[model samples]
Target: MSESGGTFDLVILGAGSGGYAAAIRASELGKSVALIEKDKLGGTCLHYGCIPTKALLHAGEVADNARESETFGVQASLQGIDMQGVHKYKDKVVGGLHRGLTGLLKSHGITIVEGEGRLTGTDEVTVNGAVYKGANILLATGSKSRTLPGLELDGEKIISSYEALRLDRVPESVIVLGGGVIGVEFASVWRSFGAEVTIVEALPHLVPVEEESSSKLLERAFRKRGIKYELGTPYESVKTTDSGVSLTLKGGKTVEAELLLVAVGRGPVSEGLGFEEAGIRMERGFVQVDENLHTGVGNIYAVGDLIPTLQLAHVGFAEGIFVAEHIAGLNPVNIDYDGVPRVTYSEPEVASVGITSKIAAERGIETTEFVYNLGGNGKSQILQTQGAVKVIAAKDGPVLGVHMVGSRVGELITESQLIYNWEALPSEVAQLIHPHPTQSEALGEAHMALAGKPLHVHD
Candidate 1:
């Protein structure tokens, strides 16, 4: 690590969600930032993960709507999915966003260094024998899709989400390993694209981190859509067949599919990046940081997937802003991780904010909950979606959590997050009138019931 150094107010490694965000904000506050990246500036979320996946999911929605148009009293038929066309659209969306992000960073007067950056010194990052110095260093290396032991990715038969995203066409059948957010979302897309999809989860339920009731509803919906899944089944092994791949479950049951997608989870990309070399403490490859995102080493901070917080990009954005303000000596408020919203964009999307009922009881907090079925919702019936809105509150206190499963319920979670973060009581939320015949009314009804008013909900 030779020093051909240039000093800056801040040095950020890995120009992903957190890194770019911090760079932009710090620059806005009159701080010179050196933002470095090995790959694209927008990183995995924009290039491979969120943006492209959502585009494919939207394509799936289009196919689904076309196929089921008869139910809407429309004569329409889904001829077939043109994956090339779909990919073109997805790439267009990604390209536009990437250009905007790149332009934004440049417009903010942030210096973007393109290379593989490693922390060679406590406040210095080395890329190609060139050292960049900073008053503070922020690590936002992000993450990569993880694979199981003995499961080598060939990028064809056995693949990670990265390779899966580049598939030219939907497989005739897919065995999705792990039923977390990534698993269910990809499965949802494949199923709607007319592919046979089966998900295998070692957990008791799909989307296991969500409320158990919400998981059950999604499972039921998937079943109705002919999306197969095996719950509480551990994966044993896999072998590639001439046709595709064979996945063996723990009980010796076997599943044959065109491909095996290892969507188990993402792991921090903190290894071999000189994190420990710079004396930055780490835990299981994740940079260890305090609530303020400080890494406990001189002028070092970490954010995004690299630090093991919520792996969502928005969380990364929030952490980036927090770190910038903290370094500016602004005494920024610490994030309430519990209040961060989570969503799984499946056919019946799942979204929640704050704590689940299971967590409430585990913490010895008394709670009362009310469920408003989407069956009674006018908008839901019109959309032909099945789900419910659940409101959980302290016995006589503020609304603590709002969980829902239905189409576009992710949008409603924003309001739920506001209610939870503001510590609004059920009565407080109930006082606000929700517009008539909308899916949001389901949330309103639940809050009303929880507030003891029971509007449109039976006692």
Candidate 2:
């Protein structure tokens, strides 16, 4: 192979968040890099995950708000949702991001190989049967949704997040399986579209990873939306017919719906990835790496969902930047997984970071919680959503976890993540005055009370 104009220093697979981030950083460091992507540039998050789902959720919120206008003393009318228009808007959103990525890659002068990449040997890779040699190789193949045994997604009745994102017609009724983040989110969307949704979760609570109190509030909020849930029960099986799907529960109870969404979870995509061929170490399905994000193989690295840390798109971006900087001879800050915030775009919008109150107590840590009622918040009252913020902290130390359930609570989690990760004490946070008559003040008040200096708490 001709060395062309220059010899590439790094070659990366999967032009998703991690891959493009690595390529851009590497280019900035004066490294000639080649990025290979089998599909569109932005990958899953832009195409099917974050961007599209949020758009749908926003539309769903609008639909619900329009229907509930009588409570606000104004009559708003909604004829029906145009599902085709939703798809158009979703596609338009995705296209804009994809175009931006293409422009950025071109400006950086990085070579774009449009094909599936596989490892042929150490420091060498093959894309579309053409060999490319680099000083180092990075594999960042992301994950896909794991299907349940008895409930496979067929894109019509049984569906996954992807199918949910591209739904052309809103179903009259839906039985959502696995009350995880995705499940509850779609349940919110389906319910807003006037579908009677029943969520079946094997866990004892909805959003099991969240604080128990937050989960309870979410349950209460969901019930008011006409969404039914069957928590702590396993779904026996799903039978699809011409009309729709029939879901059987553990107790012989059956739920018939025009659609069934299986939002169980996702698994890493490592099969046929050619990792073993390159002699890279991986466990089960995830790539194994060190603190520096380096695979055991010389100069080769792995990051993102493949690393088994937090399977979040933002986490992948951070890891990709970490890898590029480490290669450029710069020491980057290591991410603490505990401090990484997780959010579900449901009606109540679950978001949290650090330790839940339950986990802290189970570990024998002394903790106290402060709950701020959303009804006490002016902005929440304005939106007619009185969801509260719950903060857990050490008896007299830094904050442990912050959880919330109500309208528009996801935006407040950033403060929680920062405080927990920085070990910011309640006294320290309480000293800063937040703008009054705002929902964020709810956070400030919660901190003040937790610090034993009650501010807005009625005596």
Candidate 3:
């Protein structure tokens, strides 16, 4: 192979959400950028993670709607799931987004390099014997599915979310290991798709990182939906059975299923990538960076799942933009991770932003919280969904957090993010009228109750 050399203002490794976002922002700021990826662009999110999973979730939602159409007074009959057709629909969405991203990158004049890249120096990366030099190098290698030491994924009966996504047929029964976002999401989808689903989590509650109240609510919803869970139990071992697989929990409880999905979590893809060789500090495979995302070695920086932060795609996007603007000498403000909105797209979606009550207490801040049942919301009643909006605010101070569980509550999180980031007071949010007969009204009503004016709610 002929060797080539090119220099750019920024050379980004791993053209996922973070790398691409940085490239676009840097290019927009009049800087040359080279985005390198070994696999397809848009990375895991578009290929196997967020995009495709959400498509499956949406399809599952449709199946659920059809099954429960009698409640809505609609004459739709419940039908079997078509896994082939679901894959086609999921692929179509991913394909369209990938095309748009490629076009956007090209329009910005960003160079797209297709190869596995390694940092040879602080300012240099070598890919396919071609050396690309940059004034700044960003590591955005993203993450991969993580599994336990003894539990090996054979990609068949024992599998991860990646393999689970590509399954041609829904299993008769599935045991999901890990009740965090990924695990719960897959459980929801499989349950809606007519599978007997069970979730195993070592934590005391599902979505353990979320507020305890939110976790309890989600657990209740899951229980009501016939989803089984073994909470606060650790995994011991697994063995492939004649039918599928059998999982042994901490207490010697055995659970059998046609498939055992190890949705444990994702680990950073930083090994054997020359990150440490270039003097970047790493702990447990995650690159350590300062608040500004600088690697403290040279002009090198790291973002996304490579860094020890919230491993969300949107977080990666924001971090990428921040790094680009920082490199451009714009002095961008540091990201307040707590203000970031988080959504779990399950049957009854969970969305939140800012600090929970537990977080406030940990920080020694006194707080008061209010919960507005969606049962009182007209739109929620119309949609036949049951959940609530929870608002947490400082004692006589600003709104500190907002959490919700209901259908399509993810759509309302942007406003909650603004409330949390701007530190809006309960009264301030109460004064602003949310549209009548909408799910958003739940938030407004919660704030109103907290602000000492209960509307359509018993004080």
Candidate 4:
């Protein structure tokens, strides 16, 4: 490879959420950056992951509202969904965001390289036989959806989340393998789209990473939606029948569906990128990074899904900014991964920040919890949504966790994370008033109860 592309101040390996962010921010701080990517600029989150999945979820919401319009005093009939139109809308949204991102990178004066990148040296990356060197290198290679060892993704009967997004019509029935965030989100969409969805999880509950209370509420909601789920049962095998698919469980139980979606999770894309060959330390397929995102190789750093802190796009953005500032000698604060907000955008969305009750107990922190039912909130009754706000505080200390399960509760998690990260006591949070009749008031009410001044809460 010819070392022709001259040294830059910083070279970014992927233009996903983290890499693009670092490129733009480092450029703002007076560092010339080279942003290299194999596919689209916005990467999976914009093209296939967050943006598109959320659009499908929104389409599901629209369908649900139409089906249940009679309760709102509107006698409207729900017609069938046109998957073509849904895909059109999703693609349009993704394209607009991609264009905007491209424009931003151009305006920031960052060089965008279009090809596959590999680290040949500590401060160098080679793309299509062309070598680009930088005084410092940042790797943000991102991740890809993972599949089971024996399950082969044929992209038709057996599919990943990427293929599920491009289906032309809703399946009559779907067997979703995995009860985590990705599986549940797709299950919610398929159910709302009028499909008979069955979720299978090896875990004891759906969304098992969330608070136990939240998981129970979600299971109830899913049951009410007529979405069947088999928990604590491991998958045995799957075979494509003439029409759809036949999935077998450990107990010889069989499920027939038009499709099977594999949503186990995502794995870092670090295999063939030459990180190990270049002597960068890696653990369990993820690059090992310090608190400052350093890769322990000469001025090289890794961020985003490449480093296993959190696989969220927002987390990637924060890591990117942190790396950029740290490289620029600004010495930015390290991200507290525990305090990061997590949201599962399913029906009756689940959102939380900080440790759960289980985690707190595991850490030997005694806690006092208060649950505020949304049924008392005027807005919740008006919207006909059933859920609650839960505040988990220390026995006499600050709030450690805030977990919510309800419609639009994801929006309130920002405030919840703020309270957790700030180490605000229940009394401190109770001093402020949440607007009356709003869903957020449930949060305020929970805090009030935690502070020993219960309002609209039963003893």
- Candidate 1 lDDT, 23-59, residue by residue in tens: 9889988898989888998998999899999999999
lDDT tens digits by residue: candidate 2, 31-101: 88988888888778889888888888888988888998888998788889999988888789888888888
| Cα-based lDDT at residue 425, candidate 2 | 86
Listed in order, each prediction's TM-score against the native is 0.98, 0.95, 0.99, 0.98
Could you give candidate 3's per-residue lDDT for residues 87-164 as a string of tens digits?
999999999999999999999998899889999998999999999999999999999999999789999999999899
lDDT of every predicted structure (CA atoms): 0.92, 0.84, 0.93, 0.93
Candidate 2 clashing pairs?
none
Candidate 3 segments exceeding 4 Å error: 1-3
Alpha-carbon shift of residue 216 in model 1 (angstroms): 0.1
lDDT of 1 at 324: 92
Off by over 4 Å in 2: 1-7
RMSD of each: 1.6, 2.1, 1.2, 1.5
Task: Quantify how close model 4 is to the true structure by its C-alpha RMSD in Å.
Answer: 1.5
Worst 10 residues of 3 by lDDT: 1-10
In model 1, what is the error at residue 248, expressed in angstroms?
Answer: 0.8
User: Global lDDT for candidate 4?
Assistant: 0.93
**Which residue pairs show collisions in model 4?**
none
- Residue range with the least summed lDDT across 10 consecutive positions in model 4: 1-10
Q: What is the lDDT of residue 12 in candidate 4?
A: 91
